[model samples]
Target: MAKITKKEVEHVSRLARLELSDEEKETFTKQLNNILTYVEKLNELDTKDVEPTSHVLQIQNIFKEDEIRESLPRERALSNAPDRTDEFYRVPKIIE
Candidate 1:
């Protein structure tokens, strides 16, 4: 792979709306080059037989069986509210 240049780093920084110093540009050039080198190394791995996967481990949702249960009456449910009408709790208006 070609070495990452200072000009390329500056161009990327400008595209990203970043104001990088000269030192920062040099540092980023070296770092980006190192990252590309590591990626190139990874390209050498044998992955022909390996299957592509989104995650390393299997995921599953464990849930209890749903059952019908007794529920509180409307009046009992609204007993602790600061303000309520015949059916629903009243809250302060939040939007115009």
Candidate 2:
């Protein structure tokens, strides 16, 4: 059980600089306690002897097989360039 107390709640509120009304503090205390109780229940679950799996569903690597091929010659590769100089694409200067 997520045991909580008024003093702890008050301390946290003070740290947060929250000017919580008594009613708000009480409500939050109950709500936070419930959340913590749920977490405690989850902690009680038996995870031993369970293999660590990456995902719940089965998935295989979906990719095309790699193949080797000769690359295009530099001259032909740059043939479609808007502007080329010295076998390389050229752009407007940007540095000051």
Candidate 3:
């Protein structure tokens, strides 16, 4: 990877919403350059047939089906509320 200049570091910091001091920018510039160098080394590897992995472990779909179950009785659902209308919990109006 090419060495990063101070100008590039400041531009990247602006893009990332970071407010860095001159010292911090200098420090991050060196750190980011080193990280890029490592990534560049990884790009040199031959992995033509290797599959890209999202994680180190092989993961399967872990979600349950979305079918609805019977809901709680209205009285049970409102048991813990401080305020309710005849059929629903009520709250202070938040929208105009």
Best-to-worst ranking by TM-score: 3, 1, 2
Q: Between the candidate structures 1 and 2, which one is better when assessed by TM-score?
A: 1
Q: Write one digit per residue (lDDT tens) for candidate 2, span 1-96.
A: 446777788999999998889998899899988887777886687998878888988989788768887889999899899998997899999797
Q: Cα RMSD to native, each candidate?
A: 11.4, 14.5, 8.5
List of clashing residue pairs for candidate 2? none
Off by over 4 Å in 2: 45-96
C-alpha lDDT of residue 29 in model 2:
90
Return the lDDT, model 2, position 42.
67
Off by over 4 Å in 3: 65-96
Cα-based lDDT at residue 5, candidate 2: 73
What are the per-residue Cα lDDT tens digits for candidate 3 across 11-82? Answer: 988999989999998898898888877778877889999998889877887997899988898899899999
TM-score per prediction, in order, is 0.44, 0.42, 0.49
Clashes of 1: 0
Model 1, TM vs. native: 0.44
lDDT of all predictions: 0.87, 0.85, 0.88
